[model samples]
Target: MTDSNIPVTEDELHAYVDNELPGERLAAVEAWLATHPDDSARVASWRAMSDTLQAKYGAVADEPVPPRLSLDALARPPRRWMMGAIAATLVAFVAGGSVGWIAHGANTKQSMFANFTDDALDAHKLYVVEVRHPVEVAGNERAHLQQWLSKRCGYQVRAPELDANGLKLVGGRLLPGPSGPASFLMYENASGERFTIYASRATTEATQMRYAANDGNGAMFWADRGVGYVVSGPTDRTRLQHVARLVYDQTEKTGL
Candidate 1:
């Protein structure tokens, strides 16, 4: 719609919603929105929600803090038991002649999917707010993205199709893992709610799923053959499990 030939992008739309885009790009976005009713509605809804949140909570900064929340009152010296705990941990690592601290329990019988769960949730929080460059490869380049990440990670990485559900793939990227490379895939629904799938090489032969909750997010992590997969989303346990089943089914069918 504008003189520029460049097509509108999801990042541009997000920036427009958050008012982060430069002034020069405003006209192009508005012009694009004019022709796209769906995007226009989405933008309006986002703005309304943003305005409501700001209006409802914007005054908290000026209010007097509650006694329990006072920083000075809450400050304290570290617990005495913590010192002994640290010393014990150090001894365990050194005596075992292992990779030390970080990998102290690597040989344990526990499922290593727990580690990927934490990483997946961290990645979700980091990239969810990004207005631009959310992924190294966009969904439109699905084939190339799969090939590129697969080669980089030493596995056959396939983008799980969730289009049948309300969610659609946004894109994916390559990320570092505990031992090597990892692949991250992002998806979003019409309501702008998002989910992420992170995959890396397996550290254990665990095929059973591991469920974990952290902060405000939840994940279902598992390992099949040589690959580990984690599906992460908000802390709605039932909903996250539902989405996890879809991911598990798709990846299991093409896990190679």
Candidate 2:
């Protein structure tokens, strides 16, 4: 392992799930995961997905192709009109398959954003532990923080007031998101409980808020006007949803 303090990356998580992480790094990753419940949950999800895929397709790889799809069958001669019909059918099939694959690929790309929750959770965990320098800009400098994040993110970024929900803005920072530059805002309540909001360019234009929770962490994700937003906090679903709704309402009113 490079260093205990070095952050574990998304690729490293994947490698760990695949059992391909280097031996030297294994202990470090495992130790890091021990304290990061969100990451541990993500690892478990990946393992489950891998197991499900193997169970569903493992037999297919060992099976022989159907006779109709064999080279011999394809090479057999046919009447000229039959050959013409086959060619026409094949052309139609290829065209339809191409369109199908394109649509499937697009759907796949959109679905990949579900992983964005992981990124939000990771950022939440990384900074929430900071005692003094939790954010690059302090909450007192809200105007500057918002303006800086907006300019860098190429979007109108707003740090929604959470006072009504018993949370106050702590600060914000810029981050690299799945799509592009992201704006991250942190909020803390009187008890020092912290929450974060991550916003960035989105693949989808608009979406309803959806919740995902791992261990003790919860996040609600949505997209609007070419931007995606994630609200992350502790795993209190009702409380988290209330906070997320406040953020959502503010964005709607401000047209962000």
Candidate 3:
């Protein structure tokens, strides 16, 4: 059905798919769906595509830990003590020559996680505009989404409620993390502006926050407890941080 023919606006359809609509607005959409079966079918098809996406990538978190990640192997000493000393000396020399190298490894890890955040934002930018198929799992199926993602990520997944920030639980997706799988939960404002919070495990340090601007998208990344989180959008820095704080609070409350 065309936009004009449908009772909901394209933006509303987008919100519906994102689970941004609620209360009267959500009820309105339900009422509209009751009268417009074709539109309902279209929405269903779109949701199916989201489901397929989740099926394909969601399990990345659940994959067996790679052999390279074996702690015993990593902790094993070098075969030759002299050779190990020499290697350590060489590393120290390299670290001394380039302070950036010391920071580089940590920076590189952050960059890798940042790239995942970019992917999450890209997915949000792409599918949020879509009238159909905005999410693989609907908001109503949130419990199932949580169970599935938590199981996959090997951590409990809790959907953060953001009503205080004028955002609500839209739904979440499981994405790949640095070591394994990660999670991305999206929220939006009434004006259709959207923001997303992405979290994964960090190898370097405790959660800290950094701001970055990439191709007009502003992102803020932080690590707390064990998970690293990145919040990104086209919105202003202050607004982005506001949203990030909400995410942080919810995540903290969830103990994730």
**Root-mean-square deviation of every model:** 9.5, 16.6, 11.6
Where is model 2 poorest over a 10-residue stretch in terms of lDDT? 66-75
lDDT of each: 0.72, 0.75, 0.63
Ranking by lDDT: 2, 1, 3
Query: In angstroms, what RMSD does candidate 1 have relative to the true structure?
Result: 9.5
- Pitting candidate 1 against candidate 2, the one with the higher TM-score is 1
In order of appearance, the predictions have TM-scores of 0.66, 0.60, 0.58
For each predicted model, how many residue pairs clash, with residues at least 3 apart or on different chains? Answer: 0, 0, 6
Instruction: Return the TM-score for candidate 3, rounded to 2 decimals.
Output: 0.58
Model 2's number of clashes is 0
- Where model 1 places Cα greater than 4 Å from the true spot, the runs are 1-111
Q: Alpha-carbon error at 95 in model 2, in Å?
A: 3.7
- Error at 208, model 1, angstroms: 1.2
Q: Candidate 2: where are CA atoms >4 Å away?
A: 1-94, 97-106
* Model 3 spans with C-alpha error above 4 angstroms: 1-113
